[model samples]
Target: MSSNTFKQAAEAARSKTSAMNKQSSEAVSAVKNDFLHTPVMRAALPFINGGISGMVATIVIQPIDMIKVRLQLAGEGGTTGPRPSPLSVTKDIIAQGKALDLYTGLSAGLLRQAVYTTARLGFFDTFLKGLSARAKAKGRDVTFVERASAGLAAGGIAAFIGNPADLALIRMQSDGLKPVAERKNYKSVIDALSSIVKSEGVTALWSGATPTVARAMALNVGQLAFFSEAKAQLKAHTQWSPLSQTLTASAIAGFFASFLSLPFDFVKTRLQKQHRGPDGKLPYRSMTDCFIKVAKQEGLTRFYRGFGTYYMRIAPHAMVTLIVVDYLGWLTQ
Candidate 1:
């Protein structure tokens, strides 16, 4: 009687286990089919979503970005004249004009994000997918370095293409530190580009292309590679919610990006705002020359003069943009 009961119980347990496995496999297959059918995963959706997310983030961070640029352009030696802090810059900008003047280059910023962020993010995703597929086919996993390279390449290309908008942004922000009479008073990003082309030639639009592209490459590294790694690590090791994980990863990525790119940004701003004289001669001969002049006159610290303001701008912008992107993706699913 005991042996018969034991055999019956074992047989029932095996059958139950087999049925559960079958049900689990079916559920997984259903989810996979649904994912494949979703339009959000289409090739071009990343670019569209990336642009929307970037524009939204840019709008929210525009003020901070203005303050950062002002701080970057303030003072000669990073401490020579009356030193300008973020609060002082904000006060000056608001005191001089409408409080909204703090968003002087909103149009250009949005346009730049639309062009730069869309391409950088979209290209990276496309390259990543291709690499991942190949790796999977070959029975291997994609490496972090490969992903970082993709981010770098995408950013460089996008930044170069979007240099006109970027140059306009710097020019608009540069006016904040100038007397009203001397200011260009660009009406919009379009006006700024037209004026530059008319007065300075179309090539002037890409005045700071070198440093801008470099900054973009570094930013991509931070925003994509570092953020991806951080997020993956957070998910694997922590019990944090999706929002927390994104915020934490974005913060870390933003800091890295800002730190790596600020020096290049300072140079980009300086170069973009410079104009040739009557003789078609410019103050700075090249990126290296500008770096030397600023370093000699403003000191080495000038390159990082706006660290706090930049971090303030970059971190929240990165976090919000990524969060929005993730939210949109999740909603689609």
Candidate 2:
């Protein structure tokens, strides 16, 4: 009697445990299904994927970006200043501090990508779908002009929204150029942002918004529009695999992006890096002013001073970001 009772109790316990496990699994599955099927969640996936992809790419490319910024800012006031190569900039950064100095504004860079890429890529995808649908309704394919317009619009909107983070990134990266005593020594992106808002105004957070937006528009047109175009062309004309097509498309996009945006990017860095002097006057008044002054004084080529480094930074970043985004989209699909 005792043995049977004990066995019965053990069996009941096992049965209850199994039931609980089954219930938990069902519950998890239900939740996953809801997440996948919910309109809001589905709508938000592109932005989430874009941010994650951009952050991953930024982590890999931050050092190169740092060097690129340094190169752009090297001969600031005049064309006769030292011409620093990427190698020289890398060495100098290491000499000044450590290898990690090459990632001086990483927090700001990540923040910038999180906001900027999320919005731009999400908007681009959304716009592309709408355009494709319309074109399909008319029994036609999406045109390059339509793609470029979508990219430009997405970039402009995203840049405006992400200006604060972009400003903080430029400030942090350029801080090391200041005297040790003058450096704010921002501990993080938040610190840099708060400091800027405290010393300057909220408006100052968008110090280079004009150039930033312009650069973003140029970049998006080159990167997004050209990538789509290249991929379409490759698919239609070549016998390349999907991976080959993507890689080649991304490379083409990166070059166009770097070339088209460098001038605006150069202006953006300078404008964002500037602060009011003792007289409360900033160096450059606006995007146009900066462009003019730089062209007049520093020579027009100053805008393209770091083309090679910029290309290296932009190309790899574009490749990694697009690849990761594509993979993520595939997974989600």
- The TM-score of predicted model 2 comes to 0.91
lDDT of 2 by residue, 1-333 (tens): 699999999999999999999999999988887887699877888899999999999999999899988888887888785778889989989999999998999999999999999999999999999999999999999999999999999999999999999999988998998899999999999999999989888988989999999999999999999999999999999999988999999999999999999999999999999888999999999999999999999898889988998999899999999999999998776
TM-score of each: 0.85, 0.91
Residue 113's lDDT within candidate 2 is: 92
lDDT of 1 by residue, 235-322 (tens): 9899999889999999999999999888988888878877676998987888899899998887888898879989988999999899
Cα-lDDT of candidate 2: 0.94
